[model samples]
Target: MTVAVEFIVNQLKQVLLEEQVSTNETVRQLHGKDESHHALSLPDIVVFPRSTADVSAILKIAHVERVPVVPFGVGSSLEGNAIPIAHGISIDFSEMNAILEIRPDDLLVKVQPGVTRSQLNKELKKHGLQFTVDPGADATLGGMAATNASGTTAVRYGVMRDQVRDLEVVLSDGSVIHTGNLAAKSSSGYHLNGLFVGSEGTLGCFTELTLQVYGIPEFVTAGRAIFGTVADAVSAVTALLQAGIAIGRVELVDEDSIQQANIYNETAFAEKPTLFLEFHGNEAGMQEDIAFTEAIFEDFNCLSVEFEQDNAARNKLWEARHSLAYAYIHAYPGKKLMSTDVCVPISKLAETISYAREQLDIAELAGGIVGHVGDGNFHALLMLNPNDPQEQAKADHFNEQIVQYALLRGGTCTGEHGVGIGKMKYQSTEHGAALAAMKSIKTALDPYNIMNPGKIFT
Candidate 1:
């Protein structure tokens, strides 16, 4: 072990319980990588903190020793957000998994960093409530907030940043502070809540989060509309958004992705470019909304539209949509998943997706296209043989092409996936001078640069 890591571990052991720390090869390897294609580089040690006070102590010692500290949340992140690149200590928060408070009347829940989205939803169901952010993996709420994650439902409910009312953060200098309060809206000083939500743990570690939740929709409906081409499908969604259709979730699954989902899920969905849509509202209002939505789908020559009104069918339809990324991952056992996401304006959706298709063909890469088209954010799931450097290069080229298309059209490099190591190259091109301002913020907050080093900027 390195001198720095040994010193930090020795000091931390004095305050942390014996079971709370580990240097076992198996444990270090487990915390070394996330779901991304990034290679694993194990940290020297892994520590589990059970509460905010424990986190505060860990940070205090790491800061004094100048040992880099990486915060881990189940390691389900798509980007390399949780990877401990600096060979120091990886703080796994699974032991802190707790639902601290559930306020049914206020539509809020206070949870620890390790609490996963599915776990929160299961609990919320008892109160006739739910957390709306649904990233593909059952990622932790803190990880979701760090990466500013959103999924199929973001078209209506918004991203993780939108749901986080407050964050109890532990800074590099061992200070504990809450970003905001429980109030529904705040015009208060400097929006710290927004600052910490998508910071990717660069500025500090999120210890606790008070999130906004929603009551169950009185009625729901889902539909699968197939189109002859991606252009036609994207254009139809554009028309629906233009006509003010309030879709709870509208997803686009391409032909290749549909085939993969069918194989993994064992359900016979048509292998066509399809748009999976859902509607939420009062029982009396949904019928009219569904009718109007169907008419728009027709205007763009929807090949066929299938609606699922029963709860079981609707849930099953969404299950297929949610499982798409995993299906692609499952298709190739040994290949690493290089999942890249980008967002463009609603109008440019068709061409951006078409350009992605062209790039995939040019690179001769067998990639899957799936997206939440209600907004213009989508992912290109590329499977790369980790052993082949040439194949990895081709995947990189494909990602560059798609990102260039989005940035040229005033779109973001990432919509929900935060700028981790994978997206660092495009940050300057995407943010320009604003990126330097972000650097200033980083320097002022974590001047040591010990918090998740080699991320975001370098």
Candidate 2:
């Protein structure tokens, strides 16, 4: 180890328990990368902080040393947001995981950074509540907040930023602050909650979060709609939304994705462009919505529409949908998944997806198209042989084309996945002159660039 890093490590060991701090190669390596296809970069050391005070202390030491500090949760971020690219201190939050509070009456929950989505829901189940901003993985709440992640339910429940009522953040200089409060709405002060939630930890480290939750719906029904083409499926989603159908969740998976799901999950679903759907309401209201959705899908040339009210069947259906990513990974052994996340206007989703399919075909890459189409966000799961430079180049070009297409159409380069290293190149084009403002904010908040450096900016 470098003498500088060694000295920093010694300084950290003074404030933390010996077991909480480690310079071991295995621990450092584990903290080096997330679930992204981006290259791994190891940190100098890994520290487990048990409380907000512990996190503050770690940041104080790192700030004094002018060392980069990356906040890490369960390392499930798809864009390498948790990767310590600058090779400094990696602050792992596993030890700090605790569901601090659940105010059922207020529909709010307080949790430490390490608590995962499923863990929270499991406890909330007893109180007939659910935290609905699911990104499909059992990712930690802190990591989810960092990325401003959203998945199928975002169309109805809103994204991570909407759920975050308050954040206890440790700034770059080790000063702790709460970005928001428990109040439902506020016109007070600058909106720091929005700034910190999706900052990818570049501005501060989240120690605790106060989030909005929802009561479990009284009636739930799931459906699978088949269409002749991807365009028809996407068009159906748009029509449903325009018709004001209250969809709980709506996801689109193309023929390739369905085939992968069938092969991996061993289910006999049709190999066609499909929409996995769900509705939430009173039984009468849900039935009305489902009827409207079916009629709309039929109008869009849907081949078949099937609905299931059984909980087991609904869970099984979602399980297949959630497993789509793993299915692609399992199908392409030795190939890493490089998924593209792009969102467009709901009116433009059909054409955008058509363009994506065309680009995927032209690129001649093995990939599948899937999306939470209810909100005009979708992904192209491109599988590339990481060892093959030529293949990697092709995938890169493919991703760039899709992102650029979305940007030109007034859409975001990344709909949900935070700008980790993957989508950093397109930020200027996406944000235009506004990027300067973002940089100024970053510099003002984290002058040393110690918080998750080399993310969301070049």
- Best-fitting candidate, scored by TM-score: 2
For model 1, the superposed segments whose C-alpha errors exceed 4 Å read none
- For residues 108-185, what per-residue lDDT tens digits would candidate 1 score against the true structure? 999999999999999999999999999878999999999999999999999999999999999998999999999999
Runs in model 2 lying further than 4 Å from the true structure:
none
lDDT of 1: 0.90
- C-alpha lDDT values of all predictions: 0.90, 0.92
Clashes of each: 0, 0
Cα deviation at 439, candidate 1, in Å, is: 0.7
Best by lDDT: 2
What is the TM-score of candidate 2? Answer: 0.99
Q: In model 2, what are the clashing residue pairs, if there are any?
A: none
- How much is 292 displaced in model 2, in angstroms? 1.0
TM-score of each: 0.98, 0.99
**Tens digits of lDDT, candidate 2, 80-190:** 898988989898989888999999999999999999999999999999999999899999999999999999999999999999999999999999999999999999999
